[model samples]
Target: MSSPTTYHLVRPHVVTEIPTLDEHQQQVVDHAGGPLLVLAGPGTGKTTTLVEAIVRRIDDGAPPTRCWR
Candidate 1:
Protein backbone atom coordinates (compact mmCIF):
# COMPACT_ATOMS: atom_id res chain seq x y z
CA MET A 1 0.00 0.00 0.00
CA SER A 2 1.15 3.56 -0.82
CA SER A 3 0.69 6.53 1.50
CA PRO A 4 -0.84 9.75 0.28
CA THR A 5 1.41 12.83 -0.02
CA THR A 6 0.68 15.89 2.06
CA TYR A 7 0.70 19.30 0.42
CA HIS A 8 0.79 22.82 1.81
CA LEU A 9 -1.12 25.59 0.07
CA VAL A 10 0.35 29.10 0.21
CA ARG A 11 -1.29 32.34 -0.86
CA PRO A 12 0.15 34.38 -3.73
CA HIS A 13 0.64 37.32 -1.37
CA VAL A 14 3.30 35.37 0.50
CA VAL A 15 5.81 36.03 -2.27
CA THR A 16 8.09 39.07 -1.95
CA GLU A 17 7.86 42.12 -4.23
CA ILE A 18 9.93 42.47 -7.38
CA PRO A 19 13.45 43.89 -6.94
CA THR A 20 14.72 47.20 -8.34
CA LEU A 21 17.50 47.48 -10.93
CA ASP A 22 21.19 47.70 -9.99
CA GLU A 23 23.69 50.46 -10.88
CA HIS A 24 24.46 48.94 -14.30
CA GLN A 25 20.78 48.74 -15.08
CA GLN A 26 20.31 52.36 -14.01
CA GLN A 27 23.12 53.44 -16.36
CA VAL A 28 21.49 51.67 -19.27
CA VAL A 29 18.20 53.33 -18.42
CA ASP A 30 19.85 56.78 -18.25
CA HIS A 31 21.51 56.75 -21.65
CA ALA A 32 20.79 59.70 -23.97
CA GLY A 33 19.64 59.59 -27.59
CA GLY A 34 22.18 57.67 -29.65
CA PRO A 35 22.99 54.17 -30.86
CA LEU A 36 23.14 51.58 -28.10
CA LEU A 37 23.62 47.86 -27.86
CA VAL A 38 22.91 45.43 -25.05
CA LEU A 39 24.75 42.13 -25.08
CA ALA A 40 24.23 39.67 -22.30
CA GLY A 41 22.97 36.23 -21.48
CA PRO A 42 19.31 35.40 -21.13
CA GLY A 43 17.55 36.65 -17.97
CA THR A 44 20.08 39.51 -17.59
CA GLY A 45 17.43 42.31 -17.91
CA LYS A 46 18.35 43.53 -21.39
CA THR A 47 14.75 43.94 -22.46
CA THR A 48 13.80 45.48 -19.13
CA THR A 49 16.57 48.10 -19.40
CA LEU A 50 15.53 49.08 -22.92
CA VAL A 51 11.88 49.28 -21.93
CA GLU A 52 12.66 51.47 -18.94
CA ALA A 53 14.82 53.75 -21.06
CA ILE A 54 12.04 54.20 -23.59
CA VAL A 55 9.47 54.94 -20.91
CA ARG A 56 11.79 57.41 -19.18
CA ARG A 57 12.42 59.24 -22.44
CA ILE A 58 8.73 59.39 -23.21
CA ASP A 59 8.00 60.66 -19.73
CA ASP A 60 10.64 63.38 -20.33
CA GLY A 61 8.83 64.57 -23.50
CA ALA A 62 10.38 62.38 -26.20
CA PRO A 63 7.82 61.57 -28.85
CA PRO A 64 6.62 57.99 -28.73
CA THR A 65 6.49 57.75 -32.52
CA ARG A 66 10.17 58.76 -32.80
CA CYS A 67 11.40 56.02 -30.48
CA TRP A 68 12.60 52.72 -31.94
CA ARG A 69 13.62 49.46 -30.35
Candidate 2:
Protein backbone atom coordinates (compact mmCIF):
# COMPACT_ATOMS: atom_id res chain seq x y z
CA MET A 1 0.00 0.00 0.00
CA SER A 2 1.04 3.59 -0.53
CA SER A 3 2.27 5.57 2.43
CA PRO A 4 0.09 8.42 3.57
CA THR A 5 1.28 11.96 3.13
CA THR A 6 2.76 13.90 6.06
CA TYR A 7 1.99 17.17 7.73
CA HIS A 8 4.51 19.45 9.39
CA LEU A 9 4.09 21.83 12.26
CA VAL A 10 4.75 25.37 11.13
CA ARG A 11 7.37 25.94 13.79
CA PRO A 12 8.79 24.35 16.92
CA HIS A 13 6.94 25.53 19.99
CA VAL A 14 5.48 23.73 22.98
CA VAL A 15 1.70 23.77 23.02
CA THR A 16 0.56 24.45 26.58
CA GLU A 17 -2.98 25.65 25.95
CA ILE A 18 -5.98 23.72 24.75
CA PRO A 19 -6.39 25.45 21.44
CA THR A 20 -9.84 26.20 20.12
CA LEU A 21 -10.07 27.26 16.50
CA ASP A 22 -12.71 29.44 14.97
CA GLU A 23 -14.10 28.91 11.47
CA HIS A 24 -11.30 30.77 9.70
CA GLN A 25 -8.61 29.27 11.87
CA GLN A 26 -10.14 25.85 11.48
CA GLN A 27 -9.88 26.26 7.73
CA VAL A 28 -6.16 26.78 7.99
CA VAL A 29 -5.75 23.96 10.48
CA ASP A 30 -7.51 21.49 8.23
CA HIS A 31 -5.41 22.34 5.19
CA ALA A 32 -2.42 20.29 6.37
CA GLY A 33 -1.54 18.58 3.10
CA GLY A 34 0.73 21.31 1.80
CA PRO A 35 2.60 24.50 2.66
CA LEU A 36 0.69 26.89 4.91
CA LEU A 37 1.76 30.29 6.08
CA VAL A 38 -0.15 32.19 8.74
CA LEU A 39 0.91 35.81 8.72
CA ALA A 40 -0.30 38.05 11.48
CA GLY A 41 0.80 40.03 14.49
CA PRO A 42 1.47 38.72 18.00
CA GLY A 43 -1.38 37.83 20.36
CA THR A 44 -3.41 36.91 17.32
CA GLY A 45 -3.59 33.27 18.35
CA LYS A 46 -0.86 31.88 16.08
CA THR A 47 0.16 29.20 18.57
CA THR A 48 -3.43 28.33 19.29
CA THR A 49 -4.13 28.01 15.60
CA LEU A 50 -1.01 25.93 15.00
CA VAL A 51 -1.71 23.67 17.98
CA GLU A 52 -5.18 22.99 16.67
CA ALA A 53 -3.73 22.21 13.29
CA ILE A 54 -1.26 19.70 14.68
CA VAL A 55 -3.84 18.19 16.98
CA ARG A 56 -6.18 17.70 14.08
CA ARG A 57 -3.50 15.81 12.17
CA ILE A 58 -2.79 13.53 15.13
CA ASP A 59 -6.48 12.99 15.60
CA ASP A 60 -6.61 11.86 11.98
CA GLY A 61 -3.93 9.19 12.73
CA ALA A 62 -0.62 10.69 11.60
CA PRO A 63 2.36 9.78 13.78
CA PRO A 64 5.21 11.96 15.05
CA THR A 65 7.75 10.25 12.80
CA ARG A 66 5.60 11.06 9.77
CA CYS A 67 5.49 14.72 10.62
CA TRP A 68 8.15 17.31 9.97
CA ARG A 69 11.77 16.54 10.86
Candidate 3:
Protein backbone atom coordinates (compact mmCIF):
# COMPACT_ATOMS: atom_id res chain seq x y z
CA MET A 1 0.00 0.00 0.00
CA SER A 2 1.05 3.57 -0.63
CA SER A 3 -0.05 7.10 0.21
CA PRO A 4 -0.22 9.98 -2.25
CA THR A 5 2.61 12.43 -1.65
CA THR A 6 1.51 15.51 -3.48
CA TYR A 7 -1.32 17.43 -5.07
CA HIS A 8 -1.33 19.50 -8.22
CA LEU A 9 -3.54 22.39 -9.21
CA VAL A 10 -3.68 24.74 -12.15
CA ARG A 11 -5.13 28.17 -11.49
CA PRO A 12 -7.85 28.36 -14.13
CA HIS A 13 -8.12 32.07 -14.77
CA VAL A 14 -5.51 34.08 -16.62
CA VAL A 15 -6.47 37.64 -15.91
CA THR A 16 -5.25 39.86 -18.72
CA GLU A 17 -5.18 43.19 -16.91
CA ILE A 18 -6.79 42.69 -13.54
CA PRO A 19 -4.02 42.95 -10.93
CA THR A 20 -4.96 40.25 -8.47
CA LEU A 21 -7.47 37.54 -7.54
CA ASP A 22 -8.29 36.43 -4.03
CA GLU A 23 -7.06 32.92 -4.79
CA HIS A 24 -10.42 31.52 -3.73
CA GLN A 25 -12.33 33.65 -6.21
CA GLN A 26 -9.90 32.92 -9.06
CA GLN A 27 -11.27 29.48 -9.78
CA VAL A 28 -14.89 30.65 -9.61
CA VAL A 29 -14.27 33.36 -12.21
CA ASP A 30 -12.36 30.96 -14.43
CA HIS A 31 -15.05 28.31 -14.60
CA ALA A 32 -17.69 30.82 -15.66
CA GLY A 33 -18.06 29.77 -19.29
CA GLY A 34 -18.45 27.03 -21.87
CA PRO A 35 -21.17 24.37 -22.44
CA LEU A 36 -21.25 23.28 -18.86
CA LEU A 37 -23.36 23.83 -15.75
CA VAL A 38 -22.28 25.63 -12.58
CA LEU A 39 -24.13 25.30 -9.29
CA ALA A 40 -23.12 26.07 -5.75
CA GLY A 41 -24.22 27.60 -2.48
CA PRO A 42 -24.80 31.30 -1.92
CA GLY A 43 -22.36 34.23 -1.31
CA THR A 44 -20.28 33.48 -4.41
CA GLY A 45 -19.60 36.16 -6.99
CA LYS A 46 -20.92 34.05 -9.86
CA THR A 47 -23.12 36.70 -11.36
CA THR A 48 -20.50 39.41 -10.97
CA THR A 49 -17.85 37.40 -12.79
CA LEU A 50 -20.25 36.56 -15.60
CA VAL A 51 -20.90 40.23 -16.13
CA GLU A 52 -17.21 41.02 -15.98
CA ALA A 53 -16.39 38.38 -18.58
CA ILE A 54 -19.02 39.71 -20.93
CA VAL A 55 -17.66 43.21 -20.53
CA ARG A 56 -14.14 41.97 -21.10
CA ARG A 57 -15.14 40.19 -24.29
CA ILE A 58 -16.71 43.34 -25.58
CA ASP A 59 -13.69 45.40 -24.57
CA ASP A 60 -11.44 43.02 -26.45
CA GLY A 61 -13.31 43.80 -29.67
CA ALA A 62 -16.03 41.17 -29.64
CA PRO A 63 -19.05 42.78 -31.21
CA PRO A 64 -22.21 43.15 -29.14
CA THR A 65 -24.22 40.49 -30.93
CA ARG A 66 -21.21 38.20 -31.23
CA CYS A 67 -20.69 37.99 -27.49
CA TRP A 68 -22.53 35.20 -25.67
CA ARG A 69 -23.31 37.46 -22.74
TM-score of each: 0.62, 0.61, 0.44
Better of 1 and 3 by lDDT: 1
Name model 3 segments beyond 4 Å from true: 1-33
Predicted structure 1: lDDT: 0.78
Q: After superposition, how far is residue 31 of candidate 1 from its true place, in Å?
A: 1.0
Q: After superposition, how far is residue 65 of candidate 3 from its true place, in Å?
A: 3.6
Tens digit of lDDT per residue, candidate 2, span 2-55? 999998869768777565677778888878576677787998888888777777
Ranked candidates, highest TM-score first: 1, 2, 3
Find the candidate with the highest lDDT and give its number: 1
Select the stronger candidate by lDDT from 1 and 2: 1
Instruction: Name the top TM-score candidate.
Output: 1
Relative to the true structure, how large is the alpha-carbon lDDT of every model? Answer: 0.78, 0.74, 0.62
Could you give candidate 3's per-residue lDDT for residues 9-68 as a string of tens digits? 888986666435455545544554577455656766666666666666788777978876
- Model 2 misplaced regions, further than 4 Å: 1-19
Q: Please list all clashing residue pairs in model 1, or write none if there are none.
A: none
Candidate 1 deviant stretches above 4 angstroms: 1-19
Residue 60, candidate 1: how far off, in angstroms?
0.8
